[model samples]
Target: MPEAAPAPGAPPHPVAGQEPGGPRVLLPHLRGFAGRLIAVMVLSLVTVVGALAQPLVIRMVVDALADSEPIKGLVAALVALVLGVAAVNAVRDFWLQRVAEGAVRAVRTRLTAHLLRLPVAEYDLRRSGDLLSRVSADTTLLRNVLTTGVFDLVTGAVTVLGAAVVMALLDPLLLAAAGLGLGLGMLCSLIAARWIRPLSERAQARLGEMTSEVERAVSAARTIRAAGAEERESRAIADRARLAYEAGVRVARVRAAVSPLSMLGTQGAFLLVLGVGGARVASGAIGVGDLIAFVLYVFYLVSPLTQAVNAYVQVQTGLGAASRIGEILAIPAEDLHGRGPAPDRAVRTPANGAAAEGADGAPAAVEFDAVSFDYGAGPVLDEVSFTAPHGGVTAIVGPSGAGKSTLLALVERFYDPRSGTIRADGVDVTELSRSQLRSKLAYVEQEAPVLAGTIRDNLLLATPDATREELLAVLDTVNLRGLAERTSKGLDAEVGDAGVRLSGGERQRLALARALLTDAPILLLDEPTSQLDANNEAALRDAIAAVSRQRTLLVVAHRLSTVADADQILVLDSGRVVGQGRHHDLARENAAYHELAARQLLVT
Candidate 1:
């Protein structure tokens, strides 16, 4: 299989599990964007200063009117204050948006890169839809946190602090009122935080479940249609979606109650400030203008206080998103480094290399030394052992569940043997790098998958650099050159998805041509002629014979005719090597082989 290309601008470091606590994970991403964040903070500070100055300016205008000072000068000061606030706010808004977008882009790139590096085994157990939600929906929530949440947090903090300081200087009695209301609001917010974390986590998980259901329906649309299960599938999807909706509503209820309760605290503070400040003004302890300024500052303080509560809520949501991303990143990726031979090692052909040894050091040939495996269940191959020598084809014939395909998978190292080892050319296959072993072996699977591309692309899958002349030679060897020429685009014609445009025999021939083009020293054929008619089977057998003359071949045969001429045949029953000898010899001596031949059950 071809490896996918790496995405551009991806982060170099790995992103595994979440930090020890939620705060630690957030700190890194925040620190990474600290420079831009600082710029935003500075601009926000400027905006707050401009906003706070408005009340002082209002006080100046009020005092000037009371003293009957020059109207023109006061009017000029008001106009300049208005323009200054507008200019500062405009610049602050522009940079804030720019900084938020940049932070989100960086985060998305890192998350996507980490996800792509996850191991295949992880994918086997994970649902596509759930993973999709982490990449899409969760990331969107994070973007809101970076943009809106961060801005609100910074501006809100500054506004509240500045208002408090001004109020304390104006009237200590009125300041007490603001502090009491703020303390109560903080208490309420802290209580809401307790519920927010768990609710947000549950809501995100439910969203993932809903996404999974939708993805399942789309992926199996044809199956659902053929079985008339549309309504059933729809109901299943709706059930998951309803669960997510309920979870969201639960979070919404908390948020709804919290916001108003926060506003109520602010309202209570406003009433106290008004009553106390009004009495002080009536007693002539403070001027009317100062009281007016103090009240305006109190309103300013409430804005940030309300925003602070909302920011806390947003942080909880972001924590939920980060936890989901961390779960995917934590799956262990395939380890690429080990004690195996380097991939650049030269091919070891028998004619030019060391003598091959069997498990017993007797110079026998390919041997499976007590090999065993399992595909998440109990062992499929248990203590199985066998040998196939060079200069002849060794055919392994078996019943359907005899672990035939599993054995091939071990040799290819698509999976490693759980116990014992497999020796090819006297060296344990586990000792060789995956690329080194695979490059020397030509494998033709039972299904003969062909990708969605031109016929030329499929043939070049094994030997991408094959010359045009080399490609044509292999095509003729497999008797597919005629078919290739018949298409309007010849070798360039689109093969359609999984080669749907081609007949079964054509696909098999295409697979054969691909294997032939590699010119590997070891051929592993998995029922190569299963899809062919007699004539096509004969052609395939002939092609195999011609190629096997220069390579060691292992043929997994279901038809007696396909392996009858083999130098040796290994009869397998229930995952063990039951009989091993020449085809006719086994048929005469082994009951299972004899019964299989008599019933004409061979694929050929």
Candidate 2:
């Protein structure tokens, strides 16, 4: 497997005690900020108390006016109550915003760190863009819902309860008439939430697809344009966007039910209150001011009722996004038994000329023991065993599908073999944590990728502690000193995205320099010279030859000339090694090796 950025939407493992996509998975993130949550709740209580007081102040004013006694004092109290409501609500909103932002930041940070720790096999099953969307856009929904949905859900309930108590105090018959009808509509809206939930989740997923399409298209823009496939790619992305749009439309259609239901309940309450309260007034059962307050209380239900309905819808939307994020969290991480670093006894400090100890204390760098593996589709490595000699160059050459790269992946521990053990020194790679095992090797991938940063940043990616002189030495080794001289900021010069500013050969050499700078004893190079021209190739071969004298080098090469003089050559075909020996010896003894060398005129 190739090194990849974090991926999205692989079939995730289930969260504990929850069906795979259930909203219960959201509890951990919500629980993380208990303090901020408490603060928000306290502020909400203040807001609700202040809001509930306004209705009673109106009642006091209306009763005072009816009695023709001290209207001015009651009016002043009403003004004070209204200002208090505004003040408390403003404070509540501020706290809710802070809590929402903090929660999402922590979640995003944890998700990103977890992604880096995942086994490489996970990357094979997920699309990078989709994973990025989950981290970015999908997580944003969680924050919004946390603020709008969770907050509203809490405050709305308090407002409803306080309003209910006041309404009962104003007039029981009027309250009964309004309450029953309003409760029925709100209950029905919540029932519709079940239908709306999946649609909201699907909309987020489809949007992830759009993000995936866009990322692929952008990354391969030059290839698409060169091949004149822009229209085809654009159409594909547009189609995904269309599906996302349709999914969003369905969510909207479901959510639209909330407003009309709230409106229906509001209208229903107004009619019931007007008719019942007017009857009470005409019957001289209650004062006109009392009837007005009863109607006012009935209208008060509309504001919080609408907020509650809207908040519930937002919660459903949030759960939809949470389901996607949960899948990522649910997937088992690729930790080595969740253990810490290798014991101090097993630690191999890298000196200038280090060689890992094999079983029986034999001098070997890496050993693959009876390794057999497949990538779900079919077998890629079959009963393969090889030992990379310490302080020497061993080259693996094979046809396109012969599992040469797969062998390198196993050594890197990207995926473990099904029926074998890979050892760094005498210890099984599985016995060490991922960080521990990777510490022993420096791997350069076939397509030599550079990250978005300055030239110096890319150089020091693996071995951050290397001195400036050491950095200059590796750059010079790869014949990239001229690059340092040419750039305006020298090592500090920006490389642009993936080092696009550098030529193909420069990228490959820079990647090689990064690997060389590492203290790792084993160097694994996968077609590192694939992009180089004759001049750079010769320089790299010399560099490789010089490096191997001090460190173990295992290289996978397709082009025969690059590895023609390797100390040992392993020739593979159809997932099995058919030959292994010095280059000239293999050419004479093995038919497959002979044919490969003959094609390259290496044995003609």
Candidate 3:
């Protein structure tokens, strides 16, 4: 049985050193796009130059018109300046979009690689949907931070400052009058923007929860329908959606406030500039042409201010997403380089108080000494010990929740034992690099999950370079050859999602065949024949017997017939090894083994 998940409302397992800084988490990812940013900056400069020159040309045209002189040259210059700025703006937008997309791709690649390498324990605590959200939705949020957030903030600031300088040179009095309304409008927008960060954080977190709920419902759609609980599940999912909607509404409320406040300030400043400049014109302090040019510069300043405000808000939302993404990235992966037990450390005997040795008294292929484990709730395995010696089948039989599967999990090092030591061939399991250790054993899970792909794809998962002959050989070994033969594409036939197109028995055999293709000396099978019929079960037993001739096999079997001919059988009850011996010997001599055999009607 699988370990139970944490109870509802339990605190999430904390990842050490994973605190995320706002927006800054993306800085390292942006390093590769420095060239693109430089190009954007150059374009922005050209835009600023064009903007400054356009108003000057307009002023020249106005003055020439008042003088009644031919103004064709000035009009042409103004038109040229307008077209040039528009062309530069278009190019600037293209480069910024590329930079945004490239940055998002790099981030997603890094996130995917890191999530795959995370320890199995991490998956237990985190939902697949939540992790996927960080990769897809969260990384998408980061895209806007690059395009509209950071770059816009930078370019807008430069443009705003440039316009301000020109406005001050044009007329200090008019500049001062414009600053008043703009400052008030900016103050209102900044206050509104402050609420965006916290609201965005809440919104993204709620979305993650909603995504996890959706994934759970979809994956278990069959189960829900069989239980006639479709409406119940739908209602549960709707509840999650409603919470997400409420959170999003809150974020939208704040974002909506920002836009209107920014607009109000900009329009107020524009009006103030027009009023003041007109008064200056009337006083003869400035000509009508000067008033018109100053009014245009005021608009230029206002445009950047508006963009800067909007960008600030987007940056806040991106940072909110960064916090979620960082949480996953901050987790410490399984220590693949751990240095285990010193050479001088004494190796303890198996908990059975007898050495697990072969004919020559050499150490077993795999041995456990007083190992115990708990899954945060309570003990799943308690001081259990066993051995799978070289070149034979060692079967583990037990009632449900007897920690039958936990033993294989330990050997695989998916989770470390809470106490005691496990060794493979006299070397501490922890001492070997995870890659080196896993390469030594091939494991078939109980559910025998088959990924969505072709038969050829699934077969080549572990041994990617296995030739066609080798693939055919393993399929024949596990009696899965007929599956490929029935398909029109042979080995390339699609298995559909999780091998849904195949029968339960075929999925299990395919999983076994995949494991069998590996040259690993130890094969760990978890209820490999659980879904097989009587005939398929017997054939699988024969396959196991044949493979045992060359490699040690640890089979976790529920059916007594599956392991009736095993060299040794370990009977577990309540996480303790209650019996051990050949199946017939244990059935006759061990009380716990006898009860289990009688229950299965294997003994009279």
Which candidate has the top score in lDDT? 3
lDDT of 3 by residue, 367-419 (tens): 88888777768878888877788998999998899989988987988877777
Compose the digit string of candidate 2's lDDT tens values, residues 1-604.
3323332222455642254544555566667678877887887887777777776778788887767888888788888878887887787788778878887887788778878776676777678888999899878988867777877887888888888898888788888999877987888888877676689878988999999999999998889999999999999999999999999999998888877877787888888888888899899988887877777666667788878888888888888887888778777677754433312212332353334454456756787666776765667878777777678899999888898887888787676666666777756776787778888899999889999998889988898888889988889999999888886788898888988889999999999999999988899999999999999999999999999999989999988889887889998888888898998898899999899889988878
Worst 10 residues of 1 by lDDT: 1-10
Clashes per model (N, Cα, C within 3 A): 3, 1, 0
Candidate 3: where are CA atoms >4 Å away? 6-18, 341-356
| Candidate 2 residue 526 C-alpha distance from true site, Å | 0.3
**Clashing pairs for predicted structure model 1, backbone only:** 558-603, 559-602, 559-603
Positional deviation of residue 153's Cα in model 3 after best superposition, in angstroms: 0.4
Q: Can you rank all candidates by TM-score, best first?
A: 3, 2, 1
Candidate 1's residue-wise lDDT over 39-91, tens digit each?
Answer: 77787787788788888888988898899887687678778877887887787
Question: What residue runs in model 1 are displaced by over 4 Å at the alpha carbon?
Answer: 1-34, 70-112, 340-367, 387-397, 412-415, 423-426, 429-572, 580-585, 593-600
Q: TM-score per candidate, in order? A: 0.78, 0.93, 0.95
Question: Which of 2 and 3 is the better model by lDDT?
Answer: 3
